[model samples]
Target chain A: MNLLTDLIFDYTLRNIALGAAVLGIVSGMLGSFAVLRRQGLLGDTLAHAALPGICIAYLLTGSKSPLVLFLGAAISGWVATLVLLRIVRETRIKEDSALGVVLSVFFGVGIMLLTFILKHNDANQAGLDKFLFGQAATVTAEDVNTMTILGVFALLVVAVLYKEFKIMTFDPNFAASLGFNDRWLGVILTSLIVVAVVIGLRTVGVVLMSAMLVGPAVAARQWTNRLEAMVLLAGFFGALSGVAGALISVSEANLPTGPMVILSLTVIVIISLLFAPQRGILWDIKRFSKA
Target chain B: MEIVITGILISVACALLGTFLILRKMAMMSDAISHAILPGLVAGYFFAKGPDLFAGFLGALVAALVTVTLVEALKNTQRVGGESAIGIVFPAMFALGTFLVARFFENVHLDTDAVLFGNIEFVAFDRLFIGDVDFGPQSYYVAGALCLINLLFITVFYKELKLATFDAGLAATLGFSPFFIHYALMALVSVTSVGAFTSVGAVLVVALMIVPAAAAYLLTDKLPMMIGLAAGIGALSAVLGYGLALAIDSSVAGAIVSVAGAFFFAAMLFSPSHGLIAKARRIERQRVQIGLEALLVHLLNHEGEEGEAHESEMLHLSSELRWLPQFAQQIVGVAANRGLVMQLHGHLILTDNGRRQGQQLMVH
Candidate 1:
């Protein structure tokens, strides 16, 4: 008990937990759009694409400011997204293929660059390699503040454009006919997603970031049909998983916080996907039996 | 140039797999299998105690089969769709694999990066020799053999596969078991996925397996044509993308995928029967016809409400509804030339035959 109390008070532990909490909220909010748009894989692709941006930022600035790195990451992410869209538009490739292609190419380049940097540049390139698998323990107060501001900005954008987003996603042609500027709306939503992914990269890394984005929203979707409720519940689940995973990792020195957090979100999604009311597996089974 | 050759070989293999996956509506299963095989890979490494590629392949095959069997069982027993079952099982398995890796293999350089991203640059390092002449790249042989085998299998059993894909119930009634074919296809997908994992990685493999097939689907309705087109597109994209990537110093897989996307979009917008442009034109034509019909109906309703004989309007009409203003005007001009409607003091009047035709139009 004393050990647990002592661990909670540790600065690193607090920083990790707070940073994770902020990321969870951000991922949860943006993940709702991802799930609704049926672009759940987008987050994963964008996260992988962020790696090149971090490396570039480090190379250019020689400073490890989270803000600069994140901005660079966001730009790269948007570029990846644009490439994906271009591929889908200009070629005979399917959307999933485009996503996979963009994700791998960017990530592969990032890996190569990172290796080069490690060999040639400063050996103490602090916190950059951690972006691959993520090191939540290294998150600082500055990260928390940045994440909080971004999270608030993302949430405000979602709130202001909720109806437009709903119309555009559900019936894009009709929204276009109604002169809603659906193209612009899509751009805005995608940008927000890119930003959210960039911010969360510090906490979750490229590999498991998609899980954070998809898992909570998937879980929340099982419990409700209303978009608002699902988004709220998703946010709650995200925050809960983040905090719980952080606590677990802090309590146990061997466990990595990113994967633990991802696992927690995965568990929640599995539970909801299997046993939740209405859209759950059990519910589907019951309906099938009745039919 | 080496990357280009490797890309082409990989694309052909993926194109072959993509055909079946697209036909079966199991495109996303490739993605799930790619991720689910992680635990098997880790276990294989442990047993071999090193980077044993063959062991990894065997382990991945086992993992994929288990995944397919479990997903199938869940679907049968619980009535869950393929996607949902996939959603539940693969992630859990993946998490377990990740956990195990972190716990045991953290110090051994065994990580998700190697599994998910793969190291294509090292493909040349692993050489497969054919009796003194070294086969340029080892993976080329493996992937090439698999592709050839897949092509042969598909061709030999084309009739059975086609019948099953299009109408499973009919195939079952005809004494061909779709269940066997389904499992066979799944097994093939699993094997190919494992083989391809080393070259293209997990994520890009999914693209290779689905995009080309989907693009082919947009261009044709016939299965044979679709398969051929898919292979062609896949190969073309691979070459183009690899070249582009080399020139730009970017990712080969990304360029290839983008090229595939470009093809699909073009097909979606330009295809004759179902393309966006054709559909839009059809809608426009339909709206014009509907508007004309509504206008005629409205004029007819007004005539009936007035309780008038409507002799003048009736006389000017032909089998076409001439009471509607636009139709009336058009018909009058045509009738005058044909000597059916005669004009008196700017008022249109019909001859005996014209009046008969007008009455016929109303009755019909």
Candidate 2:
């Protein structure tokens, strides 16, 4: 009981909890677009792609300003998206193939760059390597502040573009006929997705970021048909997983926060996918049996 | 020249397997199979010690078969869609594989990175010798043999494969076993994927399998033409992507995939029958036709109601329709030329013959 009180009172633990809460809210709101677009993989790809950008930013600037690294990450992420789009548009390749291709290639390049950077750079580069797997314990007050500002910005953008985003997603052709500038809408939505991914990458790492985007939204989708309700539910689920993961990781010394968060989200998704009332697998089976 | 020859051979193999993958709509299964085979690869690494390509290939093959069989069983028993089964099985299996790698083989050289993105640079290091002369690269032979085997198997059972793919029910009625064909196709996919694992890795192999076939699909509907086109596209992409990668100092697989995407985009926009551009043009033409028809109907309706032709109503009708003034004018001109309307003192009146023609047009 004494150990539990001491652990909870620790500043580091409190900071991690706060950071996870902000990340949870942001990912939950943005993941809806990702799930709707069937871009559950984009989060993973963009997160991995951020490695080189962060490394390059460090190399060029010689300072680890979260703002500069984030800018670099956004640029690389957008480039990856462009490459993915170009591949799907130009080739006879399927969307998933293009996604896999872009993801692996960009990630491979990022890994190579990271390896090179680590070998050449000083020991200060140690923490940077942790970004690949994530070390939520290392998150600072500065990170929390940055996350809060970005989260608010992302939520505001989503709020402003909610109607247009919803219409374009459900029926793009109809949206286009209404002169809704679908291209701009796509760009805005993608930018928001990229930002959400980059922010989550700091907490969850590249490998698990995609799961964060997919898991909560997928689970939330089973519970609601209305877009607003789905987004809210997804955010709530994301927060729950984030808090639970943080608590578990903090309690256990060797357990990694990112994987724990991912596992929690995965459990939520599996439950929703299998057991939720309306669109769950169990529901489908029940209906089918009756027929 | 040697590289181009090797690329062409690989492309041909990819094309053959790609067509069946696309036709079966199991294109994304290649991606799932690649990831799910990690445990097999780790196990292979443990036994083989070094980078035993064949061991990895066999392991991956076994994993692929397991994935396919399980997915098929789930689909049959649970009455689930292919995508749902794939979604559930692959991720769970992949997570399991990841757990194994992380827990037991953390320090081992075998990692997800190595399996997912293959080292093409190292592929040339292994050369299979035919007596004294080196037979190009080892992967070429391995992938080539699998491709040939796949092609032969597909060709021998072409009729059955086609029947199963197009209409499994019809094949069943005609005394053909779709189950056998399905298994054979999955086996071929497994072999091709495992064999290509060394050169392109798991992800790029999927790109090779799906992209070329998808591009070919956009260009043609006939199975034979699609197969041929897909092979050509795959070969072209492999060679071109290699050259482009060399030129840019980038990853070869990435370059190839980007190039394939470019091809697909071109087909989507410009293909004569099914391209988005063509579809858009068709929509535009239909809209024009509808507008003209609506204007003609309005004029005919007015003419039927009036004993005398009225110029005021004709002018008023043009303004009321609002959107397509030019199309409306064209309709009026066409009607007038056909002697459907007579012009008197700026008032247009429909003749008895014109009224009869209009009524006939409405009926049919």
Candidate 3:
């Protein structure tokens, strides 16, 4: 009871919890679309590509505003996708190879820019390094508010275009045949992924955001075959992990919030993998043995 | 000197493992485990009685196994795809490592930045001191041993790796466990990643692993030659990337990755068999031959027509056939030069041999 009161009363802890939960839920929903389409690696590419955008955003705006940073990240991540798609379309380089090129080259550029900024503009770059490995413990209410706004906007977009996205993800050619304009839908989906990744940047960092995108979707996939159920379950699992991570990390100051959240997600994934009925690993094993 | 030696050793180790990685379509797994080994490194450091090679190796092994096991577990569940499993496991591990660093190991000498983008220039300073004697940089010995182990493994399991990579089903039928081979290869890759990462950082280790082997793959079909060429390319890129870092005074790993990318681009453009240029040229030649054949066929059909010589009236042929005027003229000029057609008062007449050729094409 005392712990509950402390948790409810503590403003920073509450904000952190809210931010992480919102991040988890939104990324979980968006990542389901990515994971189902077999474009899980795209999330990783978007996360890395966003770094240069974040740096460029900071350089251009000279402000630490999360929204501005996020916009910058979105644009760069989108461009990286375009470049990646173009390379794959125009050349003999396979998709995996193209992914590799875009991921490393863009990250290299981002690192160069970051080191450059650190060298030349040392004073203003104090919080910038935190973006590499997130500092979720320092999240404020305003940051949470920003994440909520973005999350809601993303959810609204996904809601409005849900059917088109569903068809396109499952069968792009069929979607095109049905006059859904699959290419533009692909852009929209990629945009959503970029937004979710950018939004998760402050909480999970670039390197670890892909896990947040993949973990919940993967966990939810074990529980259900239907997309809707999986999305909802992913959101539920993600939020649960987020809240638990936030609470646990706050309770023990020695644990970092971002890692705790991811670790919590990992635990959920393990449990879901082993125990989810029907499609669960153990269930399959038992069925095989019985048969 | 020591930095270069360390770089070459790491390069050879990565490139050797990379050939199989690229072949098995598991290049990104190497990337994932390289980053995922962070938590292992931290635990290794925390528990080690002394900072030694075995500690890093043990931590790396545990981390690699955890990564491989988690990925395999996810795969077995059928819920996560292979790429997605890799995507999930590494970040979780990396995040845990970061948290471990921030929480309990704050005062420890574990620098995350150093782990990500190593200071290759400083490799000479970290000398290995065995009580009374100093034997240059510790990275050389570390990377060298890893290289030897990788070379030995490849030599011993060459046939198994080849069979499993190219055709796992066939290997399985032959009584070889493809699953066992996979685990073994991943273990070697994990150990190699740890060795290479110590000198070049984990981020650039994947680049070192993939680019050389992929470039060689594009350049050749022979397995042994591919390995040899990949090693050569790796060595060249390491040297050039090192020189580039020296010139720009920037991160050596970044420069190395950039140089490897350049090599890939070069191979993509210039490799005779599989390069983009070669493909384009092949396509261009096929298009020209196809157009010429169509032109010849059209000429033969109109050879004895009563009026409106669609094949002879060059402008009409260009318009009716939807060919550019330039292309039409080029095809016509070639046909004339090859004695396939004769121009007479804006009418095309096929020679005897041209008629035979056109008849052959029509018959076929």
| Clash totals for all candidate models | 11, 16, 0
DockQ of all models, two decimals each = 0.15, 0.15, 0.52
- Predicted complex 2: DockQ: 0.15
Model 1, C-alpha of B71: deviation from truth (Å):
5.7
True contacts kept of each: 0.08, 0.06, 0.51
What is the interface root-mean-square deviation of candidate 2? 5.3
Give the winner by TM-score: 1 or 2.
1
lDDT for B237 in candidate 1 is 81
Q: How far is candidate 1 from the true structure (C-alpha RMSD, Å)?
A: 8.1
Q: What TM-score would chain A of each candidate receive against the reference chain A?
A: 0.93, 0.92, 0.96
Per-residue lDDT of model 2, residues A1-291, tens digit only = 754564468778766777777787788878877777766666766776676677777778867766777777778888888777765665555666556546644654565456556667788776775555566788788877887888899899999989998998889999999999987888788778888877777787665566677667777888888999999998999888887778877775645566667666767877887887877788877889999
TM-score of each: 0.71, 0.69, 0.91
- Model 2 clash count equals 16
**Compared with the true structure, what per-residue lDDT tens digits does model 1 show for residues A141-211?**
88878878888898899999999988887788999999999768987888888888877788877666777
| Chain B TM-scores across candidates | 0.79, 0.83, 0.93
